[model samples]
Target chain A: MPDATQSMEAIEQPAVIKRGSRFSGYLRAISAMVWKDLTAELRSRELLSAMLVFALLVILIFNFALELDIRTRETVTSGVLWVTFAFAGTLGLNRSMAVERDRGCLDGLLLVPVDRSALYFGKVLGNLIFMLIVEAIILPVYSLLYDVNLFHPGLMAVILLGSVGYVAVGTLLSTMAVQARTRDVLLPILLFPVVLPLLVAALKASNGFLQGFNMEEIWPWVYLLIAYDVIFIAVAFMVFDFVVEE
Target chain B: MTHSSDRRLTPCGVKMIETQRLVKTFGLKPVLRGIDFSVEYGEFVALVGPNGAGKTTFLRILATLSRPSMGEVRVAGHLLPAQATAVRRCLGVVTHQPLLYGDMTVDENLRFYGRMYGVRNLQQRIEDVLEMVGLMALRRDRVRQFSRGMQQRLSIGRAILHDPGILLFDEPYTGLDQEAAAMLDTLLRDVADRGRTVVMTSHDLTRVTDLADRVDILHKGEIAASVRRGEVDLAELPALYFSVTHA
Candidate 1:
C-alpha cells in the first residue's frame, strides 16, 4: 500500500497561481473551447464541407426553380439567400454539437473547472464562426450566379445579426436534441418553430439592405434582429447549465 | 461536521470523500438505495457488483457527473451538485468511453484540456503526461488512428493532466488487450502509490484484489459487504463474493 505522508510530499505542486479573476478565466476557457472546435474543423473539415456543399446544392436548385428574370431576381434574392443560410446553418450547428456528443467531448467539456455558461458561449462562438465562413464563401458565389453585387455593408451587418440569433438558439436546442433517440430528425422540428421570428426579421432586414432602403425603413427589422439576438443569447446563457445537466 | 483525529491529511484537506444515505433513482426505479460510504485521503477503494447493481451510478455521483436523489454527498470536501464546479477542480474521472476528440492529435487534445484547466506551464505538463502514458512518440498522431489500448492510455493521461486530488475510474479496463491491460496495471499501481484517493468500479474480483485496499460488494443498490485486503484471502474472493451475493 502507498504511504499517505510520503505520497503527499512527493506530489509536484505548482509554484505559482497564474490564474486571473473569475471573469477573465471564464472568458479564457470559452475562447479555448472555441479554438478547440475551430482547429478541429480546420483539420477534419467535415462540418464545413457538409454545410458548404448543402448550401450550394440548395442555391443551385433554387436557380433553376425560380428562373429569376431581372425584376423577379431583385424580389427573390434576399429570400433565397436567407433561406439558404437558415438551412445550411442548421447543418453546421447540429453537426458541431452532435460530433461533441458522439465523440464524448461534451462530457470531457462538462468536467472542466469552468462555468457552464463558458462552455455554452464557446459552442455558440464556434458555431457562429463556422456559419459566417460558409456564408462568406456562399455570398460571392451567389453574387456571381445572380450577376448582383451582394457585398453591401448593411446586408453584411444583417447577416451577422441573423447568425448570432440563429446560433444562440440553435446551440441550446441542439444540445437537447443530440441527447434524444431521434436527434437526426428532431433538431429542425424543434428549432424551426422557435426560430421563425428571427428568420422573419432576418429576411426583412436582408431585403431592406438589398433594396437600399433608408435607415428609417429598415430600422424595424434591424431592431428586431438585434433584440432577438440579445434575448436569445441571454436566455441560452442562463438555461444552458440545465440543458447539459444529466 | 465532526472531525476524526486519526484521519490522514491530504494537500487539500482531510476526509477526501464522504456520503450519508445516498439515494439515486431513474424515473420510478431506484438504482441506489440509501447507503452510507466514505473514503479517506490516499485510499484505493474498489466497488464490485453484478450487473445493474448501481456500481456505475455510485461512481458517477462521486465524479459529480450524476446527482444523487436523496443524500448528503461530498467529494474532496465539496458538496455535490451544489459546489460541483469547485468539486470538479479537484476531481479526475475516467469513464468507459475514451472521452477524447478523435479528429485531433494527442498533443492537440491535451493542449485543449490544458488550456481549459488554465494549467500553468501547460506545454511542459503535456509533454510530461505523454511520456507518462508512453505515448511520447505518438504525440502528433491523430487519436482516431490509435489502437483502443493506446486511446485508453491517452485517456488516462488526459485525466491526470490536471493532477486532481481525487480520481474515479468507471470500468476503465473494460475493453483492452493483454498488453494494454498490463500497461494499465502498472499505471494504476503508480497512481495508487502516489496516495491519491482512487475509487474504481469493476466486476473483476481477481484483479480488484491486487489493486484495492478494500473491496466493496454492492448488490441491488446497497453495499453487501466491505472486505479488507488484509483480512480476506486473495484467492478466495470469488467464493466469498458468491457467498455474500447469493445470500
Candidate 2:
C-alpha cells in the first residue's frame, strides 16, 4: 500500500477543491444521476421495453374495443391517450424506483453530499424522459390507427405539462412506495388518487386542442394544467427529503 | 492497542463520532434504547452484538442513513438530520449490499459515484481506485457478472472513492468467502492505517479482533462493554461476547 499520508492527501485534495461552488455541484449531481439512469436503461432496455409494450397493448385494446368513426375518434383521442400514458407512466415510475431499491442504490443516492432534492429532480427528469419517449412513439401509432392529427403543438404542450405534473408526484410517491413490500401495486394506488386533478385538467385541455376549439376555450384547462404542474413540482421539491427519509 | 482514557476527544480535541441517549423505534417496538457512544478521531472501533441487538441500527444512525428517535448525535463535528449533507460529504459507508448498478460496467459505476461526489480529475481517481481494489483488468466488465468478492471489493472502492474522513461498514463480510474476507482484511487495515475514523459492526468476532483497535459490545441498544485490543484475551473474546449479550 502507498504511504498513509500520501493516500490521505490523494483522497482529500480533490474533495476539498471540488467543493468550490454549491450550485454547480448540485447541478452536476443531478445531471450525473440522470445520466446514470439513462445509461443503465439504454443498456438493459428493461424499463422502456416494459413500458412501451404495455402502452402499445393498452392502445391496441382500446382501438379494437372502440372502433369509432373518424369524428368520434377525434373526440376520444385525448381520453384514450391519457389513460394509456397514465398506466404506462405508472409502470415506468415503479420499475425505475424498484431498480434503485432492489440493488440498495437508493441508499447510495441518499448518501450523496448534495441536496437530496437534486436526487428527486434527477429522478423526475429521468421518468419524464422515459414517459415522453413512450408517448412520442404512441402518438404516431395512434395517429395512424385513428387517422387523427395528434401532432398539434397545443396538444404537445398539454402532454408535456401533464407529464411533468404526473411524474413530479409520481416520482415522490414511487420513492415512498419503493420502500414497501408491495411497491408494484402500491405506487398506482397512491399515485392515481393524488394525480386525479392534474389528469382531469390534462384530459380537458387535450380534448379542447384535439377538437380544434378556440384558444380561449382551451386556455382555461391549459392554465389549470400549468398551475397543477408548478404546484406539484414545488410540493415535491419541498417534501421529497421527508418522503425518502426513514 | 492501548485504550485512550480520554474518550471525549482525539489528540486534536475533536470527537469523530458521538451519540447520547440515542433511541430508535419502529412504530412502537424499540430498536435502540437510550444508547450513549463515542469514538475519537482516527479510531477503529468494532461494534459487536448478537442478532437483533441493534448494531446495524446504531451504525445507520451514526451514518445518517436513519434518524435517532430522541438523542443528540454528531459526526465529525456536524450534527445529524440537520447537518446531514455536511456529514455525508465526509462519511464513507459500506453496507452488506453492493449499492451498485449491475447493468453498468465497473468503470461506469465508479464514474457515476465519483460525479455524484464531485471528485476532481475523476478519470485518474477511478483508475487509482480500480488499481487499489485489484480490479483494474475487470473495469470494463459489467458488475452483474462479477463474483460476490469482486462486487464487495468494488463496493469498498465506491465507499472510499471520495476519501471521506470517517467510514462506516455494517456487516460488509456477510456473504464473502474466506479468500474474499482475507482480501477485505487487507483493505480494512490499509484504510485504518491511513488514520480515518472507522466504526464497523460485525458478527465475526475473529475478524473484529484482527481489524479493530477497540471492541465495543452493544446489547439491547446500549453499550454493554468496551475494551482495547490489549485489554481482552483473543481466545476469550467469544466467551466475553456471549456473556455480555446473554447477561
DockQ of each: 0.43, 0.47
Models 1 onward score TM values of 0.94, 0.95
Clashing pairs in 1: none
Q: List residue ranges in candidate 1 displaced over 4 A.
A: A1-17, B1-13
Report the first chain's TM-score for all candidates: 0.92, 0.93
Q: Write the per-residue lDDT of candidate 2 for residues B4-120, one digit (tens) a residue.
A: 323422324346788989899999999998988888767788999989999998988887889999989988767888999888888899999999999999999999999999888
lDDT of each: 0.85, 0.88
Show the lowest summed lDDT stretch of 10 residues, model 1 chain A.
A8-17
Model 1 Cα displacement at B243 (Å)?
2.2
Show the colliding residue pairs in model 2: none
* Per-residue accuracy of model 1 over A1-246 as CA lDDT, tens digit each: 345444443332222124478898798899998999988998899999999999999998998898878767877899999899999989998899877986577889999878999998999899999999999999999988887788899999999999999999999999999988899889999999999999999898888878888889899999999999999998998899999888
Question: Residue by residue across B1-247, what tens digits does model 1's lDDT show?
Answer: 1112123233333567889999999999999999899887777889999999999899888877788999999876679889988888777788888889989999999999988888889899999889898999989999989898899899999998988777899998898888888888788877776657889999888778878877889999999988876587666778878998888
